[model samples]
Target: MGCGRPFDEVIAIAPLQRCHVMLSWCYLLLSATMTIECLDLSECQAALGMESGAIAAQDILASSSFDEASVGPQYARIRTDVAGGAWCPSTQIDQTRYEYLQVNLHRVHVITCVETQGRHGGGHGKEYPTFYMLEYWRPGRTEWQRYKGHHQNVLLKANFDTNTAVKITLDTPIVASKVRFVPFSEHLRTTCMRVELYGCEHKEGLLAYSMPSGEFYAGHLFDDRSYDGSRNSSGFLTGGLGQLMDGRTGGEFALGNGIVSDAANAEQWVGWTKPLVEFYFLFDDIRNFTALSLHVMDSSNSIKEAAVSFSLDGRHFSHTLVEYFRYENSSVAPGPDWLSIRIPKQCGRFVLVNIRNTGKLLLISEVRFESGDAYDVEIVTDGPFVGRISSPSFEYVWLITGLLGCCFLCALLVTIIAIRQRQRKVTSPSYTGLKSTPQAEHIAVDLKTGQMKVIRDTELWLPFLNAKANSTNVYMFDSDKCAVSKILEAPANVSSVQPAESASTTPLIPLKSSSSEEDSHCLSRKELFFENMRSEYDNPSLHYAASDVRIVPLSKAER
Candidate 1:
């Protein structure tokens, strides 16, 4: 059944052969299999729903004389919010042959696809681009490149049906910082269109590199204390990275503490002593970076002017690569702002930050460099770092709680050990051994220092005299091994006697009764009494006699 075949060839094919060929083709078509796969529609939607980096755009202007009350109100409809009404710029009387819309993306992106929606109003008079072309501008380029298709075709068509949304998918993604849409439509008077850009916010092939170490310096003088590498106080001064990158725009001046330039002599005042300062960043590896950010202090008098440059080698730098950013002091109500410098993508290992002090004081709070996949380049500085969040985190609270608990546990253990030691001292048996010598004269002994003490109390001295007088009967000793006197019971006629000087050298002797019969009887009684007292001293049954004090013979030193 081939077309343009000769008549003779067609006639030669038999009816049976043609039928077989048709059956074979039908079988082949029926036997074909396709692989089906599920797609994450939400993920796709999320990618398409990214916020457009477009800060400003052409073709969004409206003439003040137009019927519309305000100009550029329609520009709001082109943002990420789809619920907002469409952007319908009133063409009014003036119209151009080739109307175009140009968008400044602010930063580079890899554009994958773009979608366009017509006005919500339904009518045959609806306006949209019948034919169009997409173009984009790269960094450092003055010219635009025409977006191409998979087959290298530079032209594209969109919105053939008015009032209907159309999506154009590019065969190949383009890396660009700005994009433009040119509409060549017959409906030029109706210059209204809603467009959305869908793309990866970063280039596909680039790898995200970690932040690098950084140091601060004043001109040629390096300050070792200026090195800082932390989340909160990433700047050479104070504050953190989160606040610096909060995207707050600025125009007025306020005062606060942050990174301030210091002279080699710490006593020298900043700005006056050191009019200029610079920060140096060292990358672990060379990187192709495109943007750098600086967050100045909240004062107009702080960080008035700055410049950034890159170099493969730190010492030698190319003048052509230098970018200057200046703040005009003459401006009314000028304040601190986050300034981002977009540079042509280039590979380098070092970034030099230079600042000129226009105000009486110079201070900068934060610095961030945009490198691989737009990851922030890290800076290392000598710092007393602070946390990024003003409020404490759960982990910090938990850590502190744990430390306190540990301290309490340690203190409890120490207290328990001390209490147990005291209990042992109170419960355990205590015994003390003291040495003494029986003397005819009275004396006292110091128990603590093991020294002989003079008897100042007459009762103590009289006990020894009573013991010597009563020596004629029997000797008696108290629990402390000191002599006890029964002087009140002694007869009044019995004279109190004093030992002679020889008594110092003589051993004390027990006195006996003079009458033999009476003495024998008295001696028998006394011996019986002594035997009973001796049994009492050695008795294990005497529970209260297990005293902590004891007496033994005096040592040579005590004697």
Candidate 2:
């Protein structure tokens, strides 16, 4: 457990709560403190009770081989074929010298026991050492120490017979990797034997430990009926202790295996080994576990009372987790057997459980330590592209709806205004085409008879005035007194004809040079043209005028 590391280099056990609890140990602090530095021994080849140790035991040394001439068959030889015998010393050598076989485990281990086998003969023939002793060497130690018995005392020699196997069960497991087997008495000069070592692997806590860390140790006893807990020297949660947190309910104590308490005398409830024993658990740092539970069988030996406590540092445990009380009384005839503690919301990494064994061997089928709070784990789906808008919420929906409503309202108002303007244009009156002037006058003239007429109702001529002007003249053809106008030029021989007598009675008006006025009365053009022509064409006068008689005035005829 001595790690050769510097003091300043500290390995973080875990960040407060992330570490997992592998087992509960009574003396973990003591072992942690002894580890001067912990190398990554995960790759280390040696450990307690390793099944592969026999093959890894390569560095073999011996006092003398039976055949010094050839060291191949006389020294350590691994048995490959049953027909061929392994390394054996010469029988002819003197029996006075001490003989020993040594192997290097290549790494440290906490050895609990060892098993040795005699040389097997094909038939009834076999060979074994008469007496032998087991010894081991620590990593940095030059001296060897004899492996002790179950009572923590060294024996001179453990006696054994030939052809029979001898098993040495150690009382206290030792911490070493290299071991030697010395045969004091053998039937032959060289002993033919094989050895096996069993113990826990000396390692860092799989998480944290250093050369200068803390150390602690506690011995545990499991119910002999179910599991061989005593055989587990590593103090790991194996057998019934391992199944304590399996999350099973009812019959927990007697589920796969049962936990039996140590035997105790009557009237003395507490015993050194059992009946009343305390168990300790350590976490990497301060933690608040939810609950602790104990399951007992419905029997006389079921646990009647228990208590719990907590500690931050392994030393001080002042907080009480639970007080003692009888969980299952003897009066109850086979009912549910379970005891639970609320844990009092305490924050600590160390927990102490004190259990009572009721006279008879207590059988606990289950134990539980709920580590954390109940929670739901949700796995969010992440897409490759980010910054995408999330689904619209209720407020977003309302805001969008309000904006759309405002837009629709504005459009409706514009449509109403446009309809009102169109209606005003349709309802109001409009005047178009020609307007009458006081100076302008219209005279209707007849072309055939050279007669001129005048009329009053200006509204009656609205159709003609509103009509678009074109080459074809619009006039009334029937005698309906419809108003119409035409200009007639006089005939070419008008000078040979004479004017009517009424035409002479109408005095001819003189013409102005720049006049656009319609003539009120028309006379023969030849007489007027001859009189007006100061200069003339040779044939006739070029200036021709129309002659028409004007109708009588409306004001003088009808009243």
- Report the CA-based lDDT of candidate 1 relative to the real structure: 0.40
lDDT by candidate, in order shown: 0.40, 0.40
Note the clash tally of each candidate. Answer: 18, 31
Candidate 2 lDDT for residue 380: 22
Candidate 2 residue-wise lDDT at 477: 14
lDDT of 1 by residue, 28-98 (tens): 43333222111112223223322353344342332221223322324423323333234444452122454
lDDT string for model 2 (8-126, tens) is 11112222332234223322321221211122223332323223435343476666555444332222332221332333444422345455677676676655566665555444335
Kindly give the stretch of ten consecutive residues in candidate 2 with the minimal lDDT sum: 205-214
Off by over 4 Å in 1: 1-96, 122-125, 186-191, 203-559
- The TM-scores of all predictions, comma-separated, are 0.28, 0.31
